[model samples]
Target: MTTQQSAIYYPAGEIEEFLPQIGRVVEIKDHELAVFRTSDGTIFAAENRNPHPKGGPLAEGIVSGYYLYDPLYDWKIDLNTGLVQAPDQGQVQMYPVKVENGQVWVAL
Candidate 1:
């Protein structure tokens, strides 16, 4: 599947609040996304809800490279593609994020 869908990108917030290696939840309309800003200044957005049975908090998950580890079920979800990698797995819906002029835009 395509990484980014053709949709309007809504302004979430500035670059400062989204620190490196930290993930935060951003809500727009009926959508909720787990937005992460990597140490290298790259940003990735994905569905806040987990695919596991417990439905862990993905936003608070640990970030290692381009993968986000689920907090509850412990799944390594790809920050860019949202593919669950190895061990126990399931796919989490991924979204598009664009940073322009130090502002974060989310395409839901």
Candidate 2:
């Protein structure tokens, strides 16, 4: 049987609160998410934990263009696709984000 998952969107914050090329950690229920706004104004969300064995927090990661570079291991993870860049092998969980009436919303 196929199970359907209904997404629940939570208000992350005001759109202006997220600076471009910066990762902001937001907690929704039991999930910790790292929300990012690219220089072009596109918003993306991903799991705040890095996939590396020694990695821990991704919210403190550096945001460059469309990818997030984990400071602990310098693991490059694509904010849009959640895939670690070449030479690295792992993926983070990505979430759907949207802006409504100037409010940033993230769905999981």
Residues 1-108 of candidate 1 have per-residue lDDT tens digits of 112456778888899999888899988878888889888888988888888877866889988888887667768888877888888778888877788888888887
Total residue pair clashes for candidate 1? 0
What is the Å distance of residue 12 in model 1 from its true position?
1.0
Error of 1 at 75 (Å): 1.3
TM for candidate 2 is: 0.90
Clashes of each: 0, 0
Error of 1 at 57 (Å): 1.7
Least accurate stretch of 10 residues (summed lDDT) in model 2? Answer: 1-10
Candidate 2 lDDT by residue in tens digits, 1-108? 111257678889999999998889999878999898988999999988888987698888888888888878978898879999999899999988878899988887
Q: Candidate 2: how many backbone clashes? A: 0
Backbone clashes in model 1, listed as residue pairs: none
